[model samples]
Every structure is written in C-alpha cells, then in structure tokens.
Target: MSSTFSLKYMSRRVSCAFNLLQVCLVVAVLALLVTASPLFAENALNGAENTAEAETEAGVAAAEVIQAPALAAIAPAPAADEPLSPRMRAALGYVAQRYRVSADALRPIFHAVQSTSQELSLDPLLIVAVIGVESRFNPFSQSVMGAQGLMQVIPRFHKDKLPANAGKAPLLDPVTNVRVGSLALEEAIRRNGGLMEGLQQFAGATRDEDQTYATKVLSEKQRLEDAANRRLGRG
Candidate 1:
C-alpha cells in the first residue's frame, strides 16, 4: 500500500472512532439524567408532604388554644350520681311546667348548660334559673336593650365569646346565645367576686336598689333547687 493511502486511511479510522466515542458519551449522559429524574420527583413529593404535615400541626395547635379554657373548666364528676342526676331532671320538669315550655325543648338544651357549667365551674341549676328569669326558655327572645336569645346576652358586647363556626346567625339562636351568655355570667361572677354581685353586674344594676334583680334570680334558683330535690325524694 502507498504511504499516503495508509496515512489517510488511518486518519479516517481515527476520526470514525472519535465520532463513535462522542455518541457513546452523549448516550451515557442522557441515561444518567433519566435515572436522576425519579429522585428529583421523589424529593419534591417529600417536601410537599412535609409542608402538609406542618400545616396539620399548626391547625391542631390553634384548636387546642380555642378549646383549652373550656376543657380546663370541667370539674370532677359527682360521686353520688352523674352531673345531671334525677334531681336535675326534676328541676327541668319544674322549669318546663312553670315556664309553659315543652319538656322536650328543655331536655335537648340541657347538654349546653351542663357543658357550660363544667367549663365555667358554675352550677347548671343556677344557669337554668338565670335563663328562666332572663327569657323563660324562649330562644327567640330579644330585649329592648338589644339583648338577644335564651340568656338575653347582648351580642355586640359578647361577640368574642362566639364559636368560630357561628356565622351571621342572629344572636337569638338558642345555642349561641346561651354559650355567650354563660361566658358573660362567668366573667361577671369573677369580676364581682360573689354570685350576687355578679348577678347584679349581669343585670346592669350598679346601685343598692338594683339588688332586686339579683334577688329575683336567686329566688328562681331556690325554686328550681326545691323542684329538683322533690324529684329526688330529698325535699
């Protein structure tokens, strides 16, 4: 073979080999990138899951804050009977009869009173008495002073006591009204340092003559207590 031909032939072979090597390198890089794609996607998914978990924890923390006060107010159960014993049933019956309300209507809302009493460390009977004096178990009752609902709580004054889910429903809603009213009474009692004083404050009675309102409430409370005792055979 001629030298020029041999040299040219060898150069062409080398060029072909270099081209093949380049193709192989490009294929290898593409394969590596494809292999890494799944890892990248997995990392993104894990990050999203972490964010969701963090949000869930934050929601739970907020719920705890809203619920802690009510939970902490619960007292130990009575040893002789459940919190709403036969005595309480009698009281409910008496109130229902005296107020001309349906016993079924009174029965359903006893849960709210019990829950409030537990949360506020107050007596359910006292709450019932207050309701009797305030609205006579009328959920739709409204006062001339803008006081509304079964407990006649002024909505604007106690808006902070409303539950988160309580939308634009009128303050006359029995459940919402009772909850806020009970909280207001709890605050009044705490502020005045005595039940009678609290009742006076709740009634907006600042003067000595204003005590009549408190006296009425106390009288109602006694009547309900008597009724409950009678039912339990303790009268």
Candidate 2:
C-alpha cells in the first residue's frame, strides 16, 4: 500500500510542473504580441498623416495655378487714344484763349505743327514761339514792314521760297501761315544748328529777346494745358 501511494504522489507532482511550463510559454508569447502590435499601429498612423499633408500641399498648388490665368485675362490693356500730357493740354488751351478761338479751331493747327515738325526734324515748340511773337497767333495780322500772318512771313519770301499754292493764297489763312512758318523754322534750325540757338540768333535785336520769347511761349503752352485739364476735370 505505501509503495503504490508514493508512485501516485510523484505522478501528480510531474503533471503540475508541466502545466506551469505551459502557462509560462503562453505568457511570453502574449508579451511579444503586445509590444509588436504598438509598433504596427504607430507605422500605420504615420503613413496616414504623411498622406494628409501631401494632399493639402497639392490642393494649395492647384488653387494658385487656377487663379493665375484668370487674373491676367481680367486685367485691361492700355488704350491707343490715351489723353495728352498735362503740359501739352495746357499749351493748347492758352493758344485757344489768346487767339479768341475755340479749342476745336486750334486742333488742325496743332496737327499741322506736329506733322510739319516731324517732317522737318524741328521742335513744334519753336514754331509755336515764333507764331506767338510774330502775330500772337493772329492769322489776319499784317505788319507795316510787310511781315504777314501767324509767323509774320514776308510776302516776298513766300513768293520766292514757297510752292505756288502758298503764293496764290492770302497770307492770313491759318493753314497756309502755319505751313510757311514751319518751313521757316526748319530753315532757321538748319542755319543755326538747333531750335533754341536759332531762336536766340534770330531774336537777338529785341529786348532780352531770346529768353523772353521762350518764356512767353512756354507760359502760353502751360496755360493752354491747364485749361484743358480743367475742361476734362483732370485737375
């Protein structure tokens, strides 16, 4: 009886030891799985965050590209018939007032001056100065010294130098006078080497004449420009 009891007790002890070993193995595997699961979850979260940031950057880039062409297309280009400079407009107004004529009346004269000046390589300001000094822009003016029209061109000079149309017309016609005056100014510039020098040399005999003449004509130009500015409500 004693021998049988010993064998049974030994077998029960061995069974308990085997069950403890099995429990220890299962605990170790559970710990390893817990640690690795956290690493996997962190990697997935990081990937999702990187994807969201990339998408945001792409959206901003797309918005900028879409807006660029729209802004450029909506912008207005400058017009071909932009208004004249303030000084030029003022000069026109002064001529109109002094001549007792409408601003429209002087447009043709202004155009003629511009055209002729370009053709002759002369300054339109110099021609304007000569007209102001010679006849105060009065196309009907005649001098006792035989100087006639806006630039006070001598009839003899016109007959000798000008074309037949110039000789046949009355010296007081504004277009004819301006045409003749422009030609004379071109000749003067050629003879004296420049517009300012020609004016100085030609007006040498009169009182403080060259500077005075330039100042007066420039002043007239300014006045005309100022008047035009007022008319246009441009200040």
On a 0 to 100 scale, what is the lDDT of residue 149 in model 1?
A: 80
Tens digit of per-residue lDDT, candidate 2, span 83-173: 5445445666767776787777666666666667667876565676677777776778887877788878777765655657544555777
lDDT of 1: 0.83
Question: Candidate 1 versus the native: TM-score?
Answer: 0.63
Count of backbone clashes, every candidate in sequence: 0, 9
Give lDDT for model 2.
0.69
Each prediction's RMSD to truth: 12.5, 19.0
Q: Candidate 2: list runs displaced more than 4 Å.
A: 1-90, 158-160, 167-169, 201-235
**Highest-scoring model, lDDT:** 1
